[model samples]
Structures are given as structure tokens and as C-alpha cells.
Target: MLGAVVAVNLLDAGYAPYRGLFAVNIALVLGLWLVLPWSRGHRGRRLASPAFLVATFALGLTGSAGTHVPLTLLAIANVAFVFGMRMAAAILAGQAALMSAIPLAVGRPMADVLREVGFLVVFAAFVLGMVASVLRARQLAERVRELTVAQERGRMAAEMHDSIGHHLTVIKMGLENAERFRDRRPEAAWDEVRQAKELTAAALADARRWVRALRPLALDGHLGSAALERLADSFSGTGVAVSFDVTGTERLLGPDTELVLYRVLQEGLTNALRHAGARFVRGSLAFEKGKVVLVVADDGKGHGQGRGFGLSSLAERVEALGGTLSSGNAARGFELRAELPA
Candidate 1:
């Protein structure tokens, strides 16, 4: 755009009597426009924006006066972007006054110069408005980028906490069970120790999968139901006797919904194995009218527990997707329920 403006001025200078002066003025304008933005690199002494504006005005005077308002407005535009609207307005106002002076000195009618001054004011207003809009759009784009990065980091943190946290919990429980039965039931204790090693291996594999992709390793190619089954089987040797039941015709839930439900089950099972000491865990995934409800109930000591960090994060995720999460002591024992739109 700057090139096009300078090209027009150079063509207009072609017919002017003081062509040499106009050519020098145009060179100064081009140099200042190109270098002003990178003035920090120049260190000590540098040509400022007013120098560019003055050169542009001088270039305009060497040709036709009012006809080259575009060149002046172009200088004002650069000021609006860099030095802001206040400086741009001051520059435009000053130039308008000088422009009127030149025409009046040449014996032109006062009314014509006034009209030209009015037009310059209007053009300056337009330039300021356009630049303001561009700046706002740039600000909004940068804000969105920042929000996207923060949300991704939060998601990764919650995912590791839920998936790997569950695996570690079960491994810990298995080791504790093995220690309790080491002498009295030597064979049974050996089985628990082996299960603990296997759980360790699975946890390591899941960690590898997490590094490769954000999605859970167990849910790699499985649908919602199969993923729940795989999650339940992870507790098989832990003696929790996890039961996964599905009701209503199975239908495809979007990835977000599926992942939220999976997290609910994971957190609930982890809580039961590590804290509740519950012998039975029943997980139910129900596909209803327009939503799905996943229920994880364990017959542990019925002590009502509030949302910990993992559950709080899950609740936030579900609520962001227009879902609800509820957990408390029910008649069965402790129950956690999450519902989301399918």
C-alpha cells in the first residue's frame, strides 16, 4: 500500500516544475516509512514519525495541493497505528492549517480552502476509526490464543491425574493386600504381588500412551462401553469385583461426552479402591433420551465426601459441556453420577 501511494506521487511529480525537490522529498518519505517501525534498531539518532509526515506534506506541495491529500492522510494513518490517534489528530490538524495557509497565500478563495480543510478532518476521522477496529481485532485474536493454551494445559493435567492416578491407587492397594497376607496365605500373597507387578506394567504403558497422545491408552480404539470394560478389568485382581452394566440401546456419544463419563468412572473407582475399601463397585452407563448418565456406586462405608481436585476438575469439565455431576452417600453406600448430552 505504501508503495502504491509513493508510485502515485512519483507519477504526479513527473509534470511538476520543481521535479528534483519533489523526487528528494519522495525518497525521504519512503525511507522514513520503512525505517520508523524498526527505529529501536537504529540506537541513538533516528528519524521520527513527524519527519515522515513533513516529507509527505512537502512531496504533496511539489505537485497539486489538495489533490495529494491521500499522501498526507497516509502519514496520519502510520501515526495512528504507531503513535496512536492523539498524535495522528495533532499531525492532521497541523497539516490542515498549513495547507490552508499555502492556498490562501496563492490568492485562492477562502471558501475552497475551508472546504478542503473540512474534507481532511473527515478523512482523518475515518482513518482513526479504521485503525481502532484493526487494533481491536488483533487484541481479540491474541486473547483467544492465550485461552486456548491455558485450556490445553488444564486438560492434560486432569487427564494424567485421573488415568495414572487410578493405576497407581490400585497398585498401592494390591501391594498392601500382599503385605497383609504374606505369611498366613503365602500362595494368595504371591498372586497379589504378581497382580501388583502387572498393574505397574499397565501404568507404565498408559504413561507412554499419554506422552504419545492426550487420549487414554485404554480408550485407544474402543467405544464408550468397551472403554468402561477395560477400565473395570484393571481392578480384576484387586478383588473389588467391579461390575459394568449398560442399559438402553447403545448409541454413539461424542468424544467429549465419552471422555467425561470415562473420567467419572475412573475417579470413582480410584476413590473406592484407595479410600472406601469397598468390596464391590457397580458401574452403569445409560443412554437415555438426549443424554447419557454414568453411575458408579460402591458399597463402602457411607461417609459423604466432597469433591477433591480430580472430581472438582471433572465437574468443571462436565459443566462446561452443559452436564451435571453429583456424588454423595446413597442408600447403597457411596454413589457418583455424571450426566452429559449425547
Candidate 2:
């Protein structure tokens, strides 16, 4: 649309001998615009390189004619808006130099040439500034979108850990208890087996809930203690006796902070039941003067050398929020602890 408007205005200004050249310049610009790939992907820029070359050729044609037409200005503005400010400025400077030299070489009066060059310079500056501002705004909007996506992914991960991990841990504990008591206490073993079956049914429901609520779940002023208690209750049928306690003044935490804390507890309890073969687990959340502290300890065999996938993920979550996480053998068992600033 812009190209057609500019071409008609330029043709109306009357350069009868250069009519064909003006038409060719317009064709080249239109062709470049048509062939340019405008997708938001890596290949878009690569594919658009040929269009840039076509734009350069169109600018050359406009300059060689030495007619007071705005074809070059149109090309420069389009390139700047599409490619970026730096490339646009470079093309503008080079085209200005070439256009100025053309009239001088033709023995046009110095004052007239200077006046034309001055007008081109002012116009190019205005176009460059406008294009630069637009590019900056585009970049900022893209960054915001990226951040929003990353945050959503983090939230879903936390929710998945809390929901799925709790159910799986309960099922595992139930099976383990059933196997251990089958020979000595058949009735108790049967009860554990029944509990495991119920947990599997509940797990299916929880899975749907997590899927339906992909958005971040708020603490709703409960902080994280209510969720922790629910997690502790799921382990009831298992031999593992789990306990949860909260200390210090309970205050609202940022969503990210609460998520990290919840995940740390979930992952810790999961590792305790699944890997450590722990019969007893104790978890605590303490809100201190300037920070919150979480500890999950299990009376099971401690880690020998390296961390597992769950611990690695937990560590990353804690560290990203400017917190510290440590896991090692305590006096009698394995312990995972995280401290985060409130």
C-alpha cells in the first residue's frame, strides 16, 4: 500500500524520461516485500537476506536517476523497520552519500545539491528514530512474553510435584507395608493393599485437577502449612510415621517462594519414602526474622555420593530464588534443608 502511494506521487512529479526506471524501482521494492519471510523463527532472518539485496538494488536505481523522488527513503524505512536500526542507518548513510554525489557529478548547482542533501539527511534521521523506537518496543514486549511463559512452567512443575508426587509416594508406602506384613499380619496387610487401591483411584482424580488448574494456585493466606498437613496425611497407612510442624510467625510469602517451599517438602518426602526406605520422616517449616527455613529428615539410609534428579531439581528451584539448599547425612539419617529470604 505504502509503496503504491509513493510510486504514484513520484510519477506525478514528472520525470518523463525516467518513467521506466521509476516503475522498475517500484517493482523491485514490491518484489522484495513479497518474498521476505516474516515468521518469528530463526530461518526468517536468513531467508530475508535476499530481500535486503533487492532493496539495495532499488536504492541504487533511485540514486542513479538523480530525480527528487522519495523511493530511497521508502526503501530505507522499510529495511529499518524489518531488519533493525543499525542496518537501516548504514544503508541510509551509504544511499545519502551516493545520491549527493550523483547531482554533483552531473554539474548541478552546488547550492541546489546541498539543499537536496540537507532534506534527505533530515528525513532519514526522523525515519531512523521512529524505526529504532519501534524495534525497542518490540524487543521489550517479546522479553515480557518469554518471562511470563517461564513463570507459568515453573508453577505447573510445582503443582505436578505436589499432586502427583504425593499420590505416588502414598502408593509406594502402602505396597511396601503390605509386603512386609503379609505373612505375619494378613488382616493389616490386606488393609494396606486396599488403601493402595484407593490411592490409585484418588491419584487419577488429582491428575485431572492438576491439568484443569495449570494456573498458579495461591496460598490464600494459609502460607504452605495446610498443604503440608495434607501431604503428611497421605502416608498414614504406610509404616512410615510422617510429621509436619510450623514455627515462627506465619506471614504471606510470594507465590514463587511458596512454590519453592512446597516443592522442596514434596520432593524431600518423596525421596525419603521411595529411595531411603525410611520408616519415619519429619518435616518442618519455620518463618524466621528475615527468611524461611525448611527441613525434611528421614530415618533411612543416607545418600552415599551424588544427588538424584529430584534433589537436583529442588536445588535449582531454591537457588533461583536466592536461597541455599543442602542435603547430607545428619547424625542418624539423611536430611534436606533449604533457607530462603522472606
lDDT of 1: 0.76
List model 1 lDDT by residue over 1-342, tens digit each: 445544555576455576667677667777776766522234332446667777777765665433556766876776666666787778777877887898899999999989988988888788778878887886796796577447756876787787789989998998899899999998989999899899898787657544534447356677779988787776666667899999999998876677678778877886786668799999999989998999999999855557676677778888988999998888867999999988
Q: Give one digit per residue, the lDDT tens place, for model 2 in 1-342.
A: 444445554655555556677567666666666665432343545445446455545544553343323545655666665566677788767767876798799999989878877888998788778767777887896796578457656866876787778989999999999999999999999999999999897787656544433423333444467766665555555567899999999887876787778777777776676568889999999999999999999999877878865677668778888999999988877999999989
Clashes of each: 0, 0
TM-score to true structure, per model? 0.48, 0.50
TM-score of 1: 0.48
What is the Cα-based lDDT of residue 189 in candidate 1? Answer: 90
The prediction achieving the highest TM-score against the true structure is 2
